[model samples]
Target: MVPTMVLVADDSQDTDRKEALRDLADAVAERGEAPVVRAFGSGSEVRRAVHSVEGPMVVVPAFVAGGDFASAQLFAGLDLEGRFDACPTAPLGAVPSMVADLAGRLSASGWTDGDGVVLAADGSTGQDERQAVTDVARMLSRRLGSPVQVGYLNSWAPSVGDAVERLQRNGRERVAVAAWRLVEDRDYDRLHEMGAASVTAPLWPSEIVVDSLLAQHRAAKARLAA
Candidate 1:
């Protein structure tokens, strides 16, 4: 087992978002049966946290819609190379388990057959990350036995409002949004305002999220062992 684990996230300037991430991290650590250190933001905090743990420590990127590539870029900016024994794992968005979670959330939010579904995420400028979001949306669509449109909170087209409007135009009376963000940010708030009949809570502090983290941790350990 890695002696220590760190749940890392890109710094959200909002305190509420930061607290949400911290709470999610704690939940993941508890459910994953490991003590996890919550590290947000860039610079000294990340550096110190990385240095505090030695020898192939597990690092979970608390980000959605971006995988290892995004993590690599963020860590590189933090100068995380050779600082400690760190094994970076895939971001939460890359996990297939999230599809199940989304399904459950949508269903719980009063989603029904024939209702339009939209997977909403904070849009990314990076093509790979945007594609990752689309991939997840497709996976969810498959599970729901319905097609799901992709919408962005920012930096992209086809906003959630646009999706709802499109679905409404097509005669779908009920529309629901499955949130892809871990915290309630501007995007999260915007989803509610977009006039979706229902919007899921942030995709964190849930059993599915914990399972995904464990899956990512196990995969990273296997890769290291191999």
Candidate 2:
């Protein structure tokens, strides 16, 4: 069994995700218990990262929607024996406190009392993944004392435009979109064009997001001890 610990952040090939992964890796590298950082985008990158890591890995699913893609494409094929499998850590989203964090993002984006909110996410193909997004919307709705809409940026229905237009039709003077991504992507600017008055910042570099990732890493370490 290998003795070293490695941290992997899984996500798409988007530029912001790559940058955020590198930044997270650099931060992780400075700590005393720091594991090696290996990040992957496509299958080729995943294979390369796997071949280079000669140790147990804890995959931190950076995707807010879910980790199925990362689990299947990136760290699923690791051949660790007498050590932790390339077990993926918990998802970044779907936690109880995340609604508050997302609310904070909306407020930070200048969301007002009557402004409609659409919790925008990178759409997921899996039922559980989409349900996770819906769960977040419900919590945010309760927190803000207003109904929150769930919208997908890709791979699902109720697109951002649809949600925003529905709010407008409902007579909401303004609507804000709360982003559920690790970092702002190309779609962010277009969100404004979709009839949103404002858009929240991505989850990257936030204490909530970083803490979630590290918490997963620590949990993985605990599992190894067990």
Of the candidates shown, which would achieve the greatest lDDT relative to the real structure? Answer: 1
Estimate, for each residue in 77-151, the C-alpha lDDT of model 2 and write its tens digit. 544455445555545656766668878888888998999988887665566677777887888888899989887
TM-score of each: 0.85, 0.83
Residue 226 error, candidate 2, Å:
2.8
Q: Any residue pairs clashing in model 1, and if so which? A: none
Report each candidate's C-alpha RMSD, comma-separated, in the order given.
2.9, 3.3
Which pairs of residues have clashing backbones in candidate 2? none
Question: lDDT of each model, Cα atoms only?
Answer: 0.73, 0.67
